[model samples]
Target: MLLENMKMAFHAIRVNKMRSFLTMLGIIIGIGSVISIVSIGDTMRSLFSSLYKDVGLSQAYISIGYWIEDVRDSDYFTMDELDRLKEIFGDRIAYIDSAPSISGEVKAGGNKLKFNLSGVDYNYQNVQPVNMIYGRYLTEEDVKARKQVAVMEAGAAKKIYGTEQAVGRTFRTEVYGSMTEFTVVGVYKKEVNAFQKLLMGSSDDTGAAFVPWTLLTWPNDLIYSCRLFADPGMSREDMNQLFQEIMFYIAKSKGRNSQDFRLTTAMDEMVQVDSVMGGLSAAVGGIAAISLLVGGIGIMNIMLVSVTERTREIGIRKALGATTRDVLIQFLTESAILSACGGTIGIILGIGVVFVGGNALGLQVVVKPAVVLLAVTFSAMVGIFFGIYPASKAAKADPIEALRYE
Candidate 1:
């Protein structure tokens, strides 16, 4: 019976193909926009989530005196104070590391490469671990001895040595206009992800090099930012309180206000991501839904017009033993098929857009089964809701009056 009704619906649509296509346009655009946004957003979220998982989420980033000018050397966390923090927190604190960001050009052989530089302490690797393809990471002895050793990312290593395994090679860079030589002790596989690309602010060609944070002789230049990762067993509340206390201690030690510093944790990032995605989905989805509503209204108007045009046919069918329920179901079926077809096309367009957009934005693309199902179901519901009144009007037509008209 459903198949028979769908055949009649197809016949009706075929009779006015252009009108039907025009009517479906709204549904297509509405569903397409929403699905594309959702797919792309989900892909981006998944990518970042993976990155944070690999980097671990038990970490906190502390930035001190960022906007404060004339900040004294006492305002920064000294090596002694860092040691005191470890002693105070004991095993509860997994690692604390400081990194100062800078940029310099390094020369190897005849090749010179300009790269982003991170002056990191030995413990920095504990929080931001990378896959080392060659040699080894910096050691406590290296930092304590103020060794002029550096680790190069694969891209940088390739640029300098034409290979990723360039251990025991020396690179030269000038610090404060004074030439300093660094022996490359390690080469690491570069992170080739959207997050890393964005963080580096360069294409795949650019590379990052890490040297001992102690290379920066001035205390004021050493601890611009620090990362502290707590033990996994620590609760969120405890970690927050502990970090607050540490910041307070820094403030007290420097004779500055505690508010001058800021600490950002993984939990904070998680909440912010959720809030932003939620709000974005709501805003974009809400606007797209207006198109669906307009489409539904157009369907209702067209269905009513169809009822008027086929009034005589409806009456003849009623007189020939067709029930009102039969007439209603046929009309409802037509509306549903029309909407379902639009939704199917919209899904295809949306997925295609996601693929293209993902490639352009350098993010992965994904099509969620649940979201696709929801879109189809929602389209059918829209049809049914709008088709009800017109179908009812058709079913209640008087056989005598409808037959007498024209």
Candidate 2:
């Protein structure tokens, strides 16, 4: 009996193919829009999460709040104090470095190319590893000797000497207000991923170079801050506790209030980013879902019209001993089938859009199976909810009156 009702419903839709297609159009557009928007949002969140992990999610920065307290040059971190901290927290800390940077320009072929000169030691690589394309990174000997040798990024090296392999080449930049020449012992490549490029733009014209931190700092120079990288094996709670202990130790050692220093971790930024992205996605998805309501209304209107046109058919079925429940179920089944087909097509269309857009933008596409399932279920429910009135109207029609009218 159910199969017969479904067959009749299918025949009705087939006979009015154009109208059925027009009715399904609304559902297709609504479901497609919601699916695409949600998928893009999830993809973006995943991209950012990956980027944060790649950039060292276990890393943290420490800075002095000069405004909070009267800071003295002696309160700055010294080599001996840094060594003591390392000795005490060797197991918890992976690497710590006071990387001071200066904005300088290199004169190349009558053009001054701006570059940031960062002072780093051999241990700096452990904190922020780089891939050396030519020659090698800074060594312990270079840092100990305070050699005037530098490692240039590939883009900067090419800009300076018209080649990426600019090893042993010398470039002059202002150091301590005096022109100092340094030999490039190495060149490293800085990889910019698709998402990074989208956010930070092209970094080909501007680049950075690394030098020995000892060369940049003088004896008794105040190091106001440093970066600390925690051991990857440590959990988030342990990492946070270790950071707080370090902050307290530094404050006590320097004879200042703990409030004088600030500690920031990459996880803080990650949490904030996740929150913002999730909220934005939900808000936009909710907006897109409004169309589904419109589609539901369209379904209801079309079903009402169908009931009126099939009034005599309903009368014939009733006269043949068909129950009111059967008439209701038949109409409901037709509406659900129409909506389910629309939703299936919409899912395909949405996924196609995500893949095409992701490929074009060089981004990773992520589509959740749960979301697709929910969309299908929701579309069917919408059809049933809207079909109730029309189904009931058809079922309540008097067989004698329906047959006599038309």
Candidate 3:
């Protein structure tokens, strides 16, 4: 019986092929819009979540004496405060790394490469650590002796040596004052940075070059930024309170009661990413939904016209043995098939757009399974909803009057 109704519906659609195609347009567009937006968002979210893991666990490196105009700006721990903090917290305090960021060009193997420079102490590795692929990381001896040593990141190493071994090789770094020479004490494999390509538009040069603080320029400017991982079973709340107190101490020293610095943890980032992306994601989804609504309305308009054109046929069927239910079901089936076909095609087109946008242009397209299922379901709902009133109106027509109509 279902097959028979669908067969009749198909015949009707084929007879009015152009109208059927036009009716399908709304469902097609609605599905396509949703798929495209969702796919991009999903891709970006996955990419960034991976990046966040590599960004080090939540604890911020507190700095000092910058362009802080307000008292609120000075609300963080400083270099001097970290020493006292260690005394108060002891083994629970994790690692402390104090460094200032700078850019430098180093000449190695007669090749010059620009690199991010960090003048690190012994505890630097424990805090802002990287995987060492060649040689060894900077040692306590290196820091104690104030050795003029430098370590290259993967991209810089490749540029300097062209796949040759960088360990023990001498490199020249032109500091502000004079040219300094250092032996390559270590080489490291770069971290997997998802954002590197997305932000830089290139996969090369993500590794940072490391140097002993005594050997690098800008010595006095080295403030403090510490990384404190929780102990095996310590509560995050306790860690936060401890860090807060440490910041307060620093704030007091600077003559400010409140520490004016940002304190971000993994929990904080988790909340932040959700809050920011949630709103943006919702806005995108909301905008796409409007298209679906418009499409549904278009279907209703087209279905109404279909009712008027088929009045004579409806009358003839009623006058013969066809019940109102059968007529209504037949019309509903036609709308359903029409919209469903359009939705299927739209899904394919939308996915194609997602692929082109993501791979060709490197834009983020993240499609949720739920979104696809919802799009399909919404399309069906639109079809039935819009088709219903028209089908019912046709079923209610008086046979004598409908047959007499032009």
Q: Tell me the deviation in Å of residue 236 in model 2.
A: 1.3
Which 10-residue window of candidate 3 scores lowest in summed lDDT? 71-80
lDDT of 2 by residue, 29-82 (tens): 888888999999899899888888877888887777757666677677877777
The alpha-carbon lDDT assigned to residue 32 of candidate 2 equals: 88
Candidate 3 similarity to native, TM-score:
0.83
Residue 370, model 1: lDDT of 86
What is the lDDT ranking, best to worst? 2, 1, 3
Any idea what lDDT model 1 has? 0.80
What tens-digit string does per-residue lDDT give for candidate 1 at 1-406?
A: 8899899889988898988887777678777877887776677667766666666778888777577877776666677777788888888778876746567787878998887777777877766788899999998888888799998898788878898888999888887667889898998885577655685477555568888877864534456666788886778788888889878877787788888887888866876786787677767777777888888888888889889999998899889987999899888988877777888888899989998977887777777988788888888888888889989999999988888767
**Cα lDDT for residue 322, candidate 1:** 76
> lDDT at 402 for candidate 1?
80
Model 2 regions more than 4 Å off: 66-69, 109-111, 215-220
Candidate 3 runs further than 4 Å off: 1-4, 14-18, 63-80, 90-92, 121-129, 176-178, 191-195, 200-207, 213-218, 221-242, 252-255, 265-270, 359-365
Q: How many clashing residue pairs appear in each of the predictions shown?
A: 0, 0, 15
Better of 1 and 2 by TM-score: 2
